[model samples]
Target: MTKNERLFISPLPRYAYWLFLLGILISILLGLLFYRQVSAMVQHQAEAELKRLSASTSDQFQVYLQQTEYGMNQAATEQYIQTAIEKRDAEVLNQLLYGWQQNRNHAELWAILDKDARIISTLRGSSDNHNPLSLNGLALRAMASANPIVSTEIINKEELARVGRNVSDRLENHHLLKQEGVLTQLVIVPVLGKNGQVLGALCGGLVLNDNQELLRSLFGNSQAMHAVYQDKQCIAYFTNDNKVSFPEQISPAMTKSCILDGQACLGQMQSDGDTYVTVSRYIFNAQNQVIGYQVLALPQSQYSQLPAWVANISLLTGFLLAIFSIIVIGNTSRIRQLFDRERQRGQESYYLGMFAQKLQECTDENEVYLLLKKYLSRDLDVIQMEFNIISADDNCMESIRFTENDQVSRVYLNQSKCKPVLTGRINIYNDDRDLHCNQIDTDLIKSHVCIPFLAGGKVAGVVGLGSPQEQYWTPGRIEYLDAYLNLIGPTVTNIRLLKLLQAKAFEDQLTGLKNRHFLDQYLLEQLAIAERYKTTLSLLMADIDRFKLVNDNFGHDAGDLVLKEVAAVIRAAVRESDLVARYGGEEFVLVLPNTSTDEAVSLAERCRQAVNSLQVIHNDYSRIISVTISIGVASYPRDGNSLEALYKLADSALYLAKNQGRNQVRTAQEYLATLQRTGCDD
Candidate 1:
């Protein structure tokens, strides 16, 4: 409540009609006292009738003004309108204004006005000027305040010409216009920017003197004439007969009050020996001061028709309210439905965004397929996903599928059998009998979609999605599936390439065993574990006996074959926990964890015996080649507790084994005992 309402209304007013004079709760109790006062003026019923008509006419004017303001506000907030204004697109702006006028209302002259009141663009209406029109002062208040303005005033001849209406002389033929200036109503509604700045205003004008459209709608068949006044001076008059005289303007003073005090006025007037009743309504500008007034007159003889006219108005009002209520209720339900759809769309967008982010973190080809499987299952009741393994050497593709239970299955098919892969497009199958992919079962899925994904400029995988209802595969869902498939294909390819590069970096190309670099990394980890647990760890260094003679006689290719055979035999002889790597050419090293020196020596002999049974033929199988390996074993924490010490002791053991015989296994303890005995003999 306002301050005045609390002081005068809430404190002391329960049923006091005097509060009506204060305009408190006027929207609810408007015209209440005026209807009560009409009884006192029954003797002069023409005045009361005039008040009824004037009040009705003023209500219509308020409605029209409010509607124009609302329409302009809607235009101001339109996406296309705002874009056009921000871009200075005059052509699109003018077309939009024209369309709005055609669809909404055309009584007002419409123009898009800049901050300075100059025409930015306008719908081609009454004004036919080659140049733009500008409202000199009518729009100034609205633009400055960033609010709507509605006022009625006499526009001078010079201002009308600037606004592209130079028809002052043409109006000399009408008797009322010859003596009085034109009354024009200007409505200015400001357009706001994104940050609440006033970008411009929409200036709409209704030329009251130009036509009888406004007055005809209000008093077309009524026995009345409406005259406009500014500062009590006659300006314009409207009558169905189009023959109102200037003498009607001079015959009345305010009967109750002038509009300057924010009160309605009733006056008596005499023109041509006839008594007329007049009522005036206030017209305000931006500052809320009365700038003009409207005087509606009714002949005293026609006062008897007042009662029937009021009854008709009351009936029409009730019917309109009933229709408006239904429209409001229906619109409320529609708004809820629209909100639900928007919320669902937002959720789908969020999930797709997460899917894109997860794709970046996958480092293995199988991980990429699993990620794809997870995404499909999130939004579908039943889903199917598969990958095509392309073997370029065999020149064939194999379709592999992992079921929900994660059982792997493969089916071989021609590359051209799947439509998506053959045509590089999406295959949409909706029935069981349709030609579908070999990996995706059409019988299981009532609705299915499949698309091929590319890697290295070639089709690498085919993705399929299934749903029970056809509506689930909307255009948006289909597009998302295609986009994600294309996304995962590249990711899987990159992971496979990285795996291949890692294998090449750590594995020996000739012997197919982990290389020396790989051993160095694994040895540190095993040694740390041994030191923590106080367990035995041994290193065995082995050399092929007479390996140089084999390579020198049978070329380097035969040597590589022999080395590969011997490395395989050693790998088969050791435990799974042991690591064997190519130490160098003609030599191999094994790092055995949790093994004693004696256990390592036994493992080395088993490998040596396995190699003794192996034979490699070279040069068209004409010559047979046999080789033996001499193995040396050293235990950690028994040989100086360091990698260098272990390696030095192992090398000395291997030299002793070679000095004794080529095919044998020796421990560092045996070698040290022999060295001490020989020294004592010396």
Candidate 2:
């Protein structure tokens, strides 16, 4: 051997080069095998956890479901719900719900949904355990699932319908009670009738960070087991009795896995530097329908130190290090470049992974927009970043621009060179324009890229990202964005669909006013607000004083027009806080919140006058028809404290108005007293 070679060689280990190469190959192969094994083990553990916890939670959910059915059965006979159903004691139901709120911690909220999913009553408080339940969130979810008709049929189905279906059980976390606070996780269980109908769901939750006992019971006493719910969906990680939390961001991988596989998912995927064993199960109702999913995960840190193949591979490779060293020395410059490229790739990959994770966690569409801006500014090392989402239905885009001095102004999305981005059709954007990057000295416009948020197979919105000059959009970045959209799009779509469904539920198609069902709900809400604020809530009952008039005289078409016109008058007469609805044919009800009986009477009188003075052109003829309305007024804690009582008093007063003289106002108490004192002896 040459002297120089001999000097470089280690005297004790001559077979080191061959052994090192062999070890490298073995290490990679063995490590992969170990990883797979660990993954399997983790999956097994996660499934076991899900089976155990899901069983427990499912049981709890069932109990609530039972309670709801029982309530429905009772309400069928009970005066409160029955009256509300028959529109006889509508105010009574509201009073009960208000009283029920006082003892909220006792149980979950139980509601009776009409064909529309509007809450009729909630025995328990909301997920936040404070605010009265509103259809804003739940209706969206209900609408997304089967249509409203399903409930009518379901209500009549047998208990057997609960069998063999994946019953949904999940937690809802939101800043409902404390504004600007961490999301609170609440458990929601649906109440399905024996006839395969959903009466309403029982919604209640364990206070986040409060019920450690229950948490440990479900997830085990593990620091890694943490549960969080977003928009009625949940994700949790468990380790022993302690729990760790998942960020409220969703990842592209998770999103894809969820949609492709279904909501309840369990898998071991690449994230950060370690592998985690995860188990996800979808929450379902008593009918075994999908609600949301629960995720149980274990970090690799827990089992990484175990005697696995990766450690063995490393141990075996050490003996062959010298052989690899010799080979590596022959190509030093190439190795350096390779290492640099890998490092760059690694950094980019890390950011992308984080971005994916956050994307999956987000529930609201707007959150996606905010995340894009943040990632471009922080992860991409951009000087200035701005983005806008073009509303497919409306012009919804934000803009920002940059000058030569790196001075950035938030330009609108409309001002950006959007043609290329629109052409790319990618859901994520970064600086992909070569010309823009080369020409711009400022960071804001240099690395501009845009991604569209698609819903229902169409571009519903766009997300744009940017960095400083000469930025190139790589396939990796595009892939990263595509991954994010894969997760975000469905969630956005679901939310949108949910809103549409809810809107359909409470709306009257012909008159475009709140329906009878909606009126009941609104009355309940107003009653509670009035009680809380100790203010008056006045109800005005007005019936179109006429000949069945428009319908009988001008046909049903003219009657429909009169109804529409009357609705418009009521809508205009009431403040936003007031509730207006078509109580029945030719009769309308207006609930004026925080209004006194005098105010309600005055409001009703105005409505009557408006109707009487209005001219209706039937059959394209300017036919001036004088229509009049009989008005009745009732106030809370005076006329009655209950919805039913108030309504009854109003109706009685309305009867008196009709009896004495049409288009006049009257009170139930006064008329009733007069009736008792002066009996017309025939």
Tens-digit per-residue lDDT, 285-400, candidate 2: 34455434455555645433233443444456553334333433433444346446545644554554556556545545556656655665564545544444455355545554
TM-score of each: 0.44, 0.49
Model 1 whole-model lDDT (C-alpha atoms): 0.66
Model 1 lDDT-worst window of ten: 27-36
Candidate 2 TM-score, true structure as reference = 0.49
**Residue 61 error for model 1, in Å?**
56
Between which residue pairs do clashes occur in model 1?
none
Which candidate wins on TM-score?
A: 2
Write one digit per residue (lDDT tens) for candidate 1, span 1-682: 8887778754546656565434443422333333334433443444444455576567546555555565566567654565556656677666655554543342445677665566677554332324434343657677778778777666665555444333454455644453344566777788888888877777766666535556665445445687666555565577755444435244445445453245568766766677766677876654566656777776655443224343333344433333433443454455446445544644554565566567666656666777778877777676556666664333777767787676678877777676777788877766655635556566566677777777656777677666665445667777657656755654555555444445655788888999887888788888889999999899999999999998899988899889988998899999998999998988889999999987888898899899999988877999788999898889987864877788888888898899998799998888889979888531
